[model samples]
Target: MDGNTNEQPPAGEETPAGVRRRPWPLRRGAAPTGVRRSLRMAGVTLAVVLVSLAGVVLGVFAGGRVDTDIGPFQATLTLTPDTSGGTTVDIPPLGALLLDSHDGPTHLTVRLGALDQMRTEALIDDPASIQRASVSAVEDVRTGVMRLGLRTVASAVLATLLLAALVFRNVRRTALSGVLALVVSLGSLGAAAGTLRPQAIEEPRYEGLLVNAPAIVGDARRIANDYTRYAEQLQRLVGNVSQLYTTVSGLPVFEPAPDTTRVLHVSDMHLNPTGWSLIRTVVEQFDIDVVIDTGDITDWGSEPEASFVGSIGVLKRPYVYIRGNHDSGRTAAAVARQPNAIVLNNSTTTVAGLTIAGIGDPRFTPDKNTSPAGSGLTKPVAEQVIGAGEQLAATVRNSPRPVNIALVHDPASAGPLSGTCPLVLAGHTHARQVSMLPQQPGLGPTQLMVEGSTGGAGLRGLEGEKPTPLSMSVLYFDKDKLLQAYDDITVGGTGQAQVNLERHVIKDPQAGEPVPVTPTPTR
Candidate 1:
């Protein structure tokens, strides 16, 4: 009432009559103008990046493959985003091999499809044809790679532009995003090309059944370092391939009768990955129903070595295994885990209409650190092996089903089982031998069959002057489940490209004397 018409109320004081106070425009839950602008820019940038990535994924999966023929082999090549830049050669059921062939942001994969049998046979018959095929293969691979690269680049650009237009919804922004994506794609490819490493072929990492790469390729470093030597090695490789085809093609055609069962007998694999390929090929080619392994599957029996047993599952046939002197309890457990694998330890199991009994060797001599003192390290005496064999014989006699085959790791262990089963299979001498034990009182005489090293004694074969031959046998059984005949298959060791197959037929199964009456060479 002091009569100051323009007088204003102090901050926090009540407003004057007839005057109104405006509320704060920036109320709760509202951000500042500068902050809002920054958030909008960030959101737009994030959207652009996400869309670009999606475009790349679409490009790779939709159109990143090319098919071509190399020599007599048909193959498909593909490019994919991967930080570990390398090349992978996939050979289907045989497994894959990875090579550090280059350095880049992408990976290259070559999947082999089929082999032209006629072309292969021609190559084998004509040495000049081999030279022509090798030259043609190189040219074909080069052209295929170029086509694949161009298609991948074009696919990426098109995909990026389409995605950018959908995301930005503006001509200017979409154009800018497309340019950015193109720049990135081209840069990545340029970087890969600039960092190529042809020498990486000297050291390839093998996977699956191709783990025998070293044995097959034969010292890649040596070949790469010397050009003249490389030429020789290449010729040898071609020769080996031709020899392999010849052997496989010459195999006797087996038309298995409905009631007849064929079993593949292998032993002393010694952890050779090539053995897997050999076994699988035989299984498919011969129509094998059951596979019997007489032990020594691994060399060290360590945890890492246990992984080799995975091949047992891949075989897709009933695998009967027993532990050898070099195999530990852990090794046995690994074999047991494989699908379709049967681990026998003083036990019996029926497979393919044949009742088989087996027992693990008592000795474990590979690694002293893992094996127990004395008994594990020392060589088992004749008495110890014979006693173990006696235990297996007792188990066979007590089985609910009549045992037709007795399996043991050592030949000595098979002695006590002479009359327990009709056929006794054993390994661990690394030599093939067949003999008929004297007739027993109650049971028929036993036919003892000992197999050699199927893996050619693994890597140890390289140490000797002459590599040991890789050996396996295919046993044919009659409809009555009686042993009839077997074909002994032997492939010459490293640097040797010879395959020898001997067919031995048993004249009389019930007779006390059984011998290889006629030994015929199939190849």
Candidate 2:
């Protein structure tokens, strides 16, 4: 051995004793430490970015349409990009049942895709099933989804590590370890996203008996934004339905009296979609012969607002609609599209065995005034209402039906037809009231009923005032085709709830009394 400190290894000669290993393949001077660090960090950064991008692509495109069966009800749902630049699930009402199950007056919402078996419990009427489905969904996510996500994350980490090793062959041992740690953490995040798989939602179900089920569907591409919101809404509806079943389970199931005509009078929906669902419920429960709506159906009566007209079109029952102050002729045109709707404006017609005549609001929409601003005794509001009432009174002058009912929007205009009509129904004021108007000597006495806003004062009603309960009247006719018992149902007032219905005995609707309610009540 030579005694030289700076000696190079001899060609083809193996090192004899204590020669140390190098941190890299190359000589120390050929590449500086800084260069090696740069290589390792750059490779790692690139690998991390690729992994994240892949994870995002997978997350966005992973979900597709899945069939969701909630007991006897079934519907298809999927999460896709929404026009609102979010994700949402679109579900058409499975049947009339779903079409009529609304959360509130105007808002219809459901998140069928977010419910795993566990969350679906709320939709079911039974307590045990809700518990089971909820537990199962949670377990599936924890045991199945978590395990699958871990596998994906681990695979991603291993692949990125191998690729980084290939690209940075000259990195130091310390730097390699650091790079591995960084890659694993980031890769774990990318893989964890797989755990968010909403496909599991298709499994959890609302399985059990349900008193009523609404159409549970909507655009759900926005589920990523807030799945909890839609999920909770479905829960509340399910809870309410459960409450209804619980309330009536012990009582006698109602069967209408023979040869009796039931008319459900609802007014001032004011574009509250919830009312239609309630209307459907009342009609089904009462075996109603005809459904009548005193208008203000649309708030502004604009073109876009016309879309809600489709809701009324779905009612399979006989429906009679009259225009109100907030309604336009176009509103009537929309009502005409509904197969069962009776357009009884300024015309006397017999429907459901009763003659009905109506007057359209004089002003239609407040902005769509009939009176061109003129120098007259009164402003447009009074002049318009009177003219419309006169037109209606003119048509009913000869008496069309023995039990003629007059439909108008304003109660002020309802009295003129007292002598002509035995029963007068009007809606415009957002409060409930009843009055007796003794007619001129020869005619029968008239009862003027002004129904409270069916929308609980509507969406606009929610502002500036304590919220009112949704209100409407169910008028029952006797074998003689005379008014007998009327139910004034109020749901969810400012401080009241649980679908309270009060039965009023109108011993003689012709007596023009206040129409006292019977103490018997159903919640």
Candidate 3:
């Protein structure tokens, strides 16, 4: 053996028995002991270097294609490079997912090619199933970063604890171990935070995880940008194609008598002072016991503009509330300050004899609104809203007392509450302001509910043949639990003369109920 002091083995030669293995190359003029320590620190700190050398290997070998299942629908997702700049997806046998089958399973398939591009296909066996399927991918890098940081920290903590046990014996080691563990944990967390992407990547595949790639990149982008548009289109389609029952029956009705408490239901006031004043006046005149304003009290959230401040003193009774599509943090805060208001985003409250559960708005579908300002709740927010609504509804439905009434911002959202509550009051259309419906057979003489200006029509001031009053509605409950509604038109001023309007009661068709339902004490 040669008398060399160097610990490294000669190239292509078998290693000497005493030398320990090291990660760095042992070339001549290589790092000294101090330099090696600095170099090790640098190597770990440079995430790009670590990623290029190691992460790429993990991504290539450990990560495979992603698969997703939407209900009965299943899809195989793969990523391919985009011949174009970024990426686009190919929907194989295009439009197959739109098939209609009530009894069949809706399945989807996707294959990633490279980069982030993928090909998607829909299974058409059950056409109806395809329509019900809501497929999407979750590509949240923050979650992954947090998880990685936590795991690394846990490992560092354990290691520090072991080192303390060995180096400092019992007492000192225990305390020092805790300090070292905390330091290592923080260091690991910092490293993870630094490595995390600033902006979320579209087509995540482990390292670049590929889920439902098309959903992650294409459909999801549209959802994020134009949720209301998508939602509206979906609503139109569902209304046209779906045969699901819109009304649920077998619910006990509240009798329209004076003994029982009745809720004055109104929502989506949309900053309409006329509507607010009308509601308050009617409640006082008819002696309503409870008021439930489902949501959207303000047109633009925040402080009510000058136009809306007049509505502040109108409410006299405690009103249960749920936020609306237009409600913002600022609006919610303002509304919360009202002594008579109870904001129940996903909470329960009781008014009079009714256990009222409330939720805000439904998820914002891009198709829901036709405005350019991105005004309404988008799909994700709408979903959260709807989910909250559903949760509240379920809570109320499951309660000891039956839900007598439900107030929602949009009349369209009342579907879920229809049968659950004996009555559902919704007002988002602004009454269509102006509408024309063509005559159709079996639809009862074309059934027109159009409005004309008060003076222009045949009737007198605030009387017959007037415009549809921008008004509030009161639900009447009697001793027997049968319920009815009364509409109040709004005038102006502080006294009863300024706010009182004519009330129209909606008669029940199934009961063959009589027209001109007389108002009993609304309380």
Candidate 4:
């Protein structure tokens, strides 16, 4: 009784002198049992998710690729994560064709590889072999895809199990991870199957050298209607390939003249991806020295549409640009920011050995909500364009250097520049026209060249029953900066794959005579 009385004080009371106080029985700062259990479960769930993600990434890296033969051609199939589900056929050193073939979290890529020479030759020479090879190619591709799916799933499951074992140190957890991986893989497969678009092969977007993919593949629907027709088409394709190879290999090395300047004239692109491809191909194939765009490079002149102008940099040639009715000041600024681009707005600049002058269109006509107040909202009137042209002519006349070429968006804007420069380029009507303006007493005549829509007038071309053709012109200049000859190039309208070129030669530039306009068809 004496010891208890000496040791004890009220629970909250402090002990005096050397007397010790017993500690409280309850443990402070400890979580409840239910909360601790919940935290443990959360940690396990997080670990499982992280392990599964790592497994999927590793599986894609290790087992996503499979090499197989598509008849005579070898190809590699690969699985890659892409929100935009599609199949891409990549032809090395050329380009790729993208098809909206399916919808899923993963993208399928079939990279065309080396061709078996013997087999290709056999298919080309024998009609029967074409049919057999076509059938075999389809079957082979099917089998290869199945094999790739199995391998990828197995790899992912194995990786998940190993990671789970290392992290959890429990067989039950590892087994659970493997099962999760399988479920995920099956779910992806099911999604792809449900959204498969077999007809997507008919509509493809081509990049780089494969921009001519539509022409090479022909109409898919017609080809699929008859096996014999399909074989015939395949035979022709092989024959064309062989012939092209032979012709190109036998041709002598080409060396363009040092004194000659080649300029590509394109206008009214209107934000067509195919138009950019065509421009790139022409720049490479024709050895173009410069690209001159009269304008309308975009539709809405919105910030989002400015990205298309980035293609100008990729052209790798001097790109002289001007704003069109549909292009706002923002669009012109975006173009000005691109590499190798020169924006002309009542200004003069020399590029690729030619002195040029250009002016922006006076009006901006964009869709509602595309531009700031008082801009890109009104249609361009004729008087406004004429005034812009008069101002540009004054600027050209006061330039420090002689302007060899003058550019404007509308033909009306080109009117005041008749005697200002030897050549005036304009595009607005979406039609091609070439004529010599009447010569002044003491000045040489000006050649007015209006280009058709390089982008087939963009989506608007398809609104009518007959789609407009995509067109451009190649101008050749001599050392004197005189236009000597030019080629008018035309690509078939929508649903057509033919190409036509017409060449015009200026017999005497100094004679103030009209250039002979002859339509020489070459396909």
Give stretches of model 1 more than 4 Å off.
Answer: 1-256, 367-380, 512-523
TM-scores vs. true structure, each candidate: 0.52, 0.52, 0.37, 0.52
* Model 4 clashes, total count: 0
lDDT, candidate 3, residue 169? 63
**lDDT of candidate model 2 versus the reference:** 0.56
TM-score of model number 2: 0.52
Per-residue lDDT of candidate 2, residues 204-301 (tens digit) = 32322111211111222332222233223323332352243334323343323688788989988876545656666666666678888888887656
Which candidate, 2 or 3, would have the higher lDDT against the true structure?
A: 2
Per-residue CA lDDT of model 3 for 52-156, tens digit only, reads 223222221222234443232233432221112121232332211211111111111242221111111121112222234433232322233344334444444
lDDT of 1 by residue, 308-389 (tens): 6776777799999999887879889989998899999999999988999999987775632121112332354657777789
TM-score ranking from best to worst? 1, 2, 4, 3
Cand. 4 TM to true fold: 0.52
RMSD (Cα, Å) of model 4: 13.8
Q: What TM-score does structure 3 among the candidates reach?
A: 0.37
Q: Model 3's lDDT to the true fold? A: 0.41
